[model samples]
Target chain A: MTTETHLVVAVLTVVAVAVIVRMVRRGVLKAKYTVLWLTVGLVLAVAASVPTLLDTVADRLGIWYQPTLFLMLAIGFLLLVAMHFSYELSRLEKRVRALAEELALLRGPVPDDTADGGATGDGSG
Target chain B: MRTAVIIPAFDEADALPAVLAELAAHVPDHEVVVVDDGSTDGTHRVAAAAGATCLRLPFNLGIGGALRLGFRYAATQGFDRAYQFDADGQHDASQIPALLAGLDDADMVVGSRFSDDRGYRVGRSRGLAMALLRLLVRRVTGRRFTDTSSGFRAFRRPVLEFFATEYPMEYMESVEALVLAVRSGFTVREVPVVMHDRAAGTASNRNLRLAYHFVRLLIVLLAGGRATGHTPQVAR
Candidate 1:
């Protein structure tokens, strides 16, 4: 119930809400990415409210202080961004290939009158 | 034959009314569809007032994306031919007849400024750049085009379908369409035509930026393939 603890809780609450809103807007919040961001946001919010949990994790990971915990958070955000970019790149390649196939068909040929007649059973072939 | 001219406009409200007027005067029978490529300016209103069917994109999709939408409309709406005309008044709409005339023999008839020994208004450096592009395109596709970069061209039904599917979003390297058509055994004829300087905005790709594009396009074409022979066309 200290003044600094109250400020940390307010800031983390605001960040968790902002990240949730962004995820919702991008439509990635519905699936695995959403769950991951939500978990991180929730954990950070709880750690702000109860600072002892931070010291317990720090002790378990053999970290001397909470600054090392901050580094883990930064790495998690970078991993998420990299994963999103790769997904977008794969989607673009599939789109390009589909387009190329359409072009191949349209530019194929005008069916010949002879083939049309033969296929229709006129038997000129 | 019913034809629709799709003029893709991007912040060219100043020059569009004049171009629409010229199109109406020379080719009154053809319908004009102007796709405003997400212009912040009042391009849609101006185009509609000037008597063109206006389709506004939600955002700027560049020239190729706009043209693909236009072509799809032309195909589904039952237009016999679809022609792409620029909004800056650089292309001469009077040459519409020649493009239509060559349509029977070719799937697409491109307006080439260098076709019949015609001169260019572009400077010496730009002129040389175009010459090198023609040579590079020739080497890659085994075909030479006078104005590989000209936006003034007409497409028959099949070419219309071809572009709707796989149109390049970038500007530099769309000659893939022409190369793909030839590979699929479609005939592409280059017709001689005059291109005027922009009446209102500047060229989309100008000067050093333009030169860089040709070099980049050349690399793509060379890397794709140089093995060229006749792709036999099925007789219709």
Candidate 2:
């Protein structure tokens, strides 16, 4: 049972990494920005294959009890999920800004992003 | 001289008003170009209120990205000189005269806190890190720069063009500017200036992380300052 579970997890991990790399190459994501996320994923995948690795990390961090395999997997997944949401939020924000700028232009710059260049009564420090 | 002061502001609304006021009082003849690098605060309103020519970057590109945009604007607008002024109120506007005066002999003039009696305080680790940086700059550029990471500096047209095309868009703009200037056979001079602690906003780096950035810059600098094609002569 243990051997089968490890094999399944390994296959899934490889597929996930391959997908991420493909997405990065296709410009769907950026490699530099995704390094931390990819590293967390890879570390979790490797740790899952070797149960003893948890003891070493736990000892180094001065944690008393050995962390459960499920907990480790959950924590790693949470981090990667957070990263995904961050990237998505930034992308959405960019799209919104573009839309806002387009709307402002169509409306002939009615006190939006383009209202900055004119003279104003506000003085400097 | 037609000068443009490039102020890269990141959520610096609280401190910028005072800095802009000082600039107006001291360097009013120069056109101010505030590069608002996607600040969430009312930085754009403050800059606009202060009557600065603003360049709103769509995202929070780092300091290098902001400065490169500023340099490009300066080049296109035909400014004779551009000064990189910090938005955090640490740089003194009163030193603009000394910086501009030094520009006659050198292509770029750097304002150094250690060059005068003015004392700037940070964590002890930062001081050690800057000492390491001074060593690295001495080794790499063959010039003794007391503060290689100070953002308070002025660049003439030639140095402005060099940065507009080849400025590395990261945290290493101060060091990279010095290296690029030296590599391009441009004379660089350091002048006495007062540096104060920032009035508002926390620094992005704590002590240990600050050391990490210094080490990162040294590695980038030692990698043979040639990748950006800013240097005319190939490293031997």
Candidate 3:
């Protein structure tokens, strides 16, 4: 990582952290999501500040290309996050569907009294 | 026994009037409960005008979701039995007695179109899909169901109560609900019944979406096991 690029990454991560903190104070983001984004920001800041950190880790993994490790990690993280999002979306949809059903049932009326006479006779009619 | 006809209508104002009229004529004693699934067309108004109980949803939930709502209402209203009647004029009101009579021996009765030559003709591809679904349903439930996708069905009180909450809220839910009822130790039987194509209002045709839902149903049947366990009364 070049020093200039590292400086940019670090600055951007700091700005992101500041924004996240502000959102937290304003209660804009849910705690779970705020924690998720803050953890991501923290990891990016650490990686930017320590240029050799990634390289050392890459060497231990026996990868000739150090950036490959970073790319792999980023891709894996993103895939997992995307899967989590889909799971959350499915759950939310199910809840909304249940709520819709409940609403309809609440508004649903009692069947008319015409069945009163029929209940007495054989339903063959 | 109080029998409720649960009609799940979605923008079927054009078709519902005739269907409800036929129902009232054939089974005057059976009260009808129509669940309007967020229709832009005043489906709710037609249902209410029919002198039937109507429940209007705030937004569109698919057929399965709408049916679940209808079942929930029927069960809560102390209905002893309930049968699903199509709002699109596809189900035969004259067949209601036959369909409901099956309930005497079984907890759930499916009005099968293919059991007799009476199953209205479908395109070749749809026929093939129907066959595959029947095979899979047979495998899943270890019981052969000639018409796995038939929406015309009747359920005894226990089945209605069970389905009030646990009914599958997805496309091809009829098959899932069939397997669910069987797995829950409820007796399910199929009766030969004639069905007609929609007399009015067009089917919301989407080949691609139907294909996707078919694949999803396959995966759920194979992996999730339509039984999803005997957990009682949990709405999904």
Q: List residue ranges in candidate 2 displaced over 4 A.
A: A1-125, B225-236
Model 1 collision count: 0
Give all TM-scores, in the order shown: 0.66, 0.65, 0.89
lDDT of 3 by residue, B30-96 (tens): 9888888888776766677678888888898888888888887888889999999988888899999
Every model's Cα RMSD, please? 12.9, 10.2, 6.3
Per-residue C-alpha lDDT of model 3 across residues A71-97, encoded as one tens digit per residue: 788899899889989988877777777
lDDT of each: 0.71, 0.73, 0.82
Leading candidate by lDDT: 3
Span of ten consecutive residues with least summed lDDT in model 3 chain B: B227-236
Question: Using TM-score as the measure, what is the rank order of every candidate, best first?
Answer: 3, 1, 2
Q: Candidate 3, which segments miss by more than 4 Å at Cα?
A: A2-8, A110-125, B199-201, B227-236
lDDT (Cα, tens digit) per residue for candidate 2, span B1-236: 79999998899899899999999999889998887776887687778777787777656767776777678778867899989998888788887888889988888999988866676776676678778878877888899898888888999998898787577655666777787778779889899888777644366766466667666777787886533422222121
TM-score of the first chain alone, every candidate: 0.55, 0.49, 0.74
Tens-place lDDT digits, model 1, residues B58-149: 56766766777677767867788888898988888888888778898888888887788655477678678778777877876788787777
lDDT of 2 by residue, A17-47 (tens): 7877777678876666578557756875776
